[model samples]
Target: MSSLEQANEVYNKYGAYELMKRGISEGLRHLSAPYENLQTEDQWVGAKYYGNFAGFHNNFGGNLAETKCRTASGNPPQIETTQESEELEAAMELRHNGYTKIGNIYDEDVIDEVVSRYNNIIENKEHTKSSHSNDPGDGNVYIRGIDSPQEEYFPEAEQLVTEKVKNILRNYYRSHIQIRNLRAYRTHHIPPELMESKEVYNNHWHCDGKTSDHIKLFVCLGETTEEDGPLHIMPKKYTREYAKRNASFDRETDGAPNNVVEEHGEPVKFTGVAGDVMLANTQTCLHRAGVPDEGRSRDLVQLYIAPSSEPLPENWIDSELEGADPNVWSRLLKY
Candidate 1:
């Protein structure tokens, strides 16, 4: 069989986790070459989180989740000796410290179309096979789940990322701003039964990644308030401090240290109407999920973009994303 055929068998029989592992082991020489040539010569400064890109190694609970699947007691937590000598590179467009917020970014006319498209795929459960469940301590935390294909994103919603987003990208990325992932999600649903459920350990303080690399644009699709689980993110000062210290807390299971919050002050929680936008670097600044009120829910669309425009592997095509638009996701995923 051809090498590509081998990759397909691994992907089809195993999963993305195994495919990624195979890539790192067998294709690291080819993979590292492209990533090494990234050049950034522009006004916007570039920052590296985790010192170097750790890729799958950077993942939280990647092993613990599987360990729990095999045995009851999860693996013991390890002390992370990274994150010393923090640097805060300023982006001209980032607001409220590390993100930019735009209120009422869309009108009903545009929102109705976007929401309708998102719901059709999610409600019908047409996951791209890349979706997985999150353990919300008590049960499946159903609010955030798998991703719908980008083909589901309508043209009207595409217009939302034009001028304002272009400027933000220019200020944030030194090289060309290439979008990495785009998906719409239904956040926590507050069913009557879940109302009495215990708070998830994940609903506390955490950062998305170790470094200041990826940028995420989060859009709210419905009415949101503090009662409905508002997003809380640390402002600049605390973020800067955390940058220089060793990673003290478990990002996947632990909340932000009480001392950090105490010294940096409380996180800024957002409350807004539909069509609100919050841009954040989840890699550097600590953030936590909002808890929607009982019986209430939230719709969110997120765009993850990065600077590198590396080439994907040849056999990368055998993986899922069968229904994804080649024009969109093809440009996004660079193995």
Candidate 2:
């Protein structure tokens, strides 16, 4: 029998509890390793396995009725108009599907201004500080140390924290949320030879190790099409199945296999015009960035957020909330 068939047989025979225990065992083993000694991929494995185990327990292991009660606010936000109703429905879809896109949230002027700023930065690369990049000179340039500038260039980013957004987040998290990090980057088309040598600019499907409560708001700074390296994401249900099939979490790479993904459901690709915003629970979904077509690039502004005791503020993009830390599990987990 095939490996997938074997996984299915094991799951059917012993049930989900058995799979959970196996996953937890592997997770504990990784967690027990010394942090300093682990390589980048190993560290990712440690955090992803253990963090996902924690997320599963938090969301599913407890009392079913109690979980429902806690998640369901007895008094939901009142919806009077069509827009309000649609926003609420989108919020529900986000919770259920692990992602949802808000179309054309920003006007053309806003997109133009943001894109112009990005172009200036790109042209004047010598003066700019980059956070990281896929290659030294060519692929996926991520602008660094521009937190304040991002706020000025793309004030529409603040729209991510508006009343409607806050309501959606609050309803989903069942708690107030705060901006964890903000980033702006441009994805340039890498050479085909380089693409063959390396992973397709995060094209390998993997889950971000952040906790389940975390959601990333991806703002397209310009018109984004399938050729522009759009994001591809699997729903939460398929992610769980993928996890079960690889309960040991001992894959060769951090990404899921294409065959396994194909065996499950189709991935949803995020492709839309400028100003579209995609809200994704990256921790719960399996996702990867598509490779942009040659001679084309994609510009984006990303916001990372998580549940917090403090309520979201209007000018959250400029707030003093903690920045994006590479060691995500360190902040969220005791170990």
Candidate 3:
């Protein structure tokens, strides 16, 4: 079998419901061939980088002076307007900057219920496991395929996307509105002890898929305040200019050159209250989860989308999870 075929085997066995369950395991297996010839490898980033656990961002230079990501420190951005205007303005912002925010999209009652269920998974040590350790003041619990406490939680919340927001996004993302991928995470600010140990890896600026057609929607289930790990993003135009210069380059393993950073100004942080829906052109802008001051908590539902017909480099998880038993997967969920 070819590498892709062999890789698909793993995905077939323990893949889907667990999401990245086999990451650390498979990553270790690949380490046997140290200094992998990834460039010559025919696989895509989802398989080569994430599947094998290639440390792309590990090469990040922590020199802030060389960074083009401007630090935006202040109160969070504010948006106060009627429903129709908010939708239009957000759509326009998404067009211009590759991101936009719509507030109070879901009823507060629903938001609270979702947060309450996730709180048990993320906060309780016995039931919780870190998706990836974060020493940089930010951490997340991957609750998509693995620890879905309530299967109905996500399918029901799917209603939150309503007709209005779908109309706003369908054109920008360039695909029929379908939930191509779904990742719901509950994040937290790591304690000082471990925080000191985490290198400036994720805190550094980066984009999801370089020069790919993708859109990510973030549903803030809890308050994302200035000090609670708010997301900061560079404007779309700057991100496009930066992407153009380094098209086809891997962001996880590289940084913006000095000349490029000099031009791309600081990114703006979007700190939204519960029930705020934020849409982002994942490939068009550089964004990261800012470190929360003290130890505040933040929870979010991340819904991913790509043009339905766009040829996505086979996502390791999506491919593997293809035939997950819905009834069995649902049974594994907890409340």
Candidate 4:
């Protein structure tokens, strides 16, 4: 029998879909060779030039004079003494330089109205009832762009994206950063129950792992304290190891894609005040949405940036939302 026919026979014995998935993964590995190291468990793979990990500003740079923080004593400030503390410090420093906070990114009254509208959408009889038994393909609703505030949701968000783009480019200069061929995406959430359980909550760290260029901003509408299930980020150092072990690219066997990160590893959680934004390099940092406690909800506006020069997936729009399974707005982008 021909190889195709023989393979079909094997698939028939096992399972066709599962086999195809594996094949696709293998093929991608061949197409994206240098990035194969990204799929490995070696966290230091990307940190060859940039040392240290974790925290606020890590995705930017390392050992550079600009990336370092000055201590209160006029010495280079060491945010903390532990390994994790150092990582967090680096991340914070990067965030400071790359991202700026525009408090009231939305009008207060308008934000209140929007928040209420979203709350009602979730509390509507259908949404509440479906919560128990249904797994809506893309949540109960999927909005591409908010019509209410066309400026902040799309135009202004797009403008702020410029700064984010600068950050991504600056960091990649010191390391291997590939811009994924995808467009920027915006997402909104108004669910309170999602933050209650680890299993039911937005537990996965979603990303645009396919393309090399990716930087996402998680914008908050309300106070995003621990009660709202603050995001947890695994320092770059840890994720570098993750890239090697989990995100490493492989060759495709048939049509199946390679495996990404496993869902079992522990993730670092994040906490932010209202109006505080989390700027992230999805490829280098592994993060997940926190679970909201009782009577609380999370309202976040997420924006992704992609450069004009890249070739996004033919099904970029649909594929970009791969991680939206649990959280409709969780996704990846490139710029």
Model 1 misplaced regions, further than 4 Å: 1-3, 6-26, 29-96, 123-133, 136-141, 144-157, 189-201, 242-246, 252-264, 308-335
Residues 1-335, candidate 3: write the lDDT tens digits: 99677668767765664435444444444553443455323123322332211123211211121121112112112223355575556767887777887667776677777666655555564334355443233444322122433233344445456656665654443334344455555555554555344433255456553213346778776778888777777776775555555445443344422224335477677688777888886544667666666556556766665333322232223332122111211111200
Task: Tell me model 1's lDDT, rounded to 2 decimals.
Answer: 0.50
Cα lDDT computed for each candidate against the true fold: 0.50, 0.60, 0.49, 0.38
Model 3 regions lying over 4 Å from their true place: 1-89, 125-128, 133-156, 173-175, 190-201, 242-264, 309-335
Poorly placed runs, candidate 4 (over 4 Å):
1-201, 205-208, 242-269, 310-335
TM-score of 2: 0.68
Give the better candidate number (1 or 2) by TM-score: 2
lDDT of 2 by residue, 1-335 (tens): 98578567657876877555545544664674574354444434433453332233223211232233344434444434354476667778888888988777655675676667666765566334554434445434522334444555445456545565666676666655667776676676666676545563465677664445567888787788889888888887777666655544432354533545556578888888767888988867778777678888777778887665444555666544445433433333211
- The candidate that achieves the highest lDDT relative to the unseen native structure: 2
Error of 1 at 141 (Å): 5.6
Error of 2 at 244 (Å): 0.8
Clashing pairs in 1: 49-211, 86-243, 86-244, 190-295, 229-291
Clashing pairs in 3: 16-321, 56-252, 57-252, 70-266, 97-236, 149-334
Give lDDT: candidate 3, residue 151: 30
Q: TM-scores for all candidates?
A: 0.59, 0.68, 0.56, 0.40
TM-score of 4: 0.40
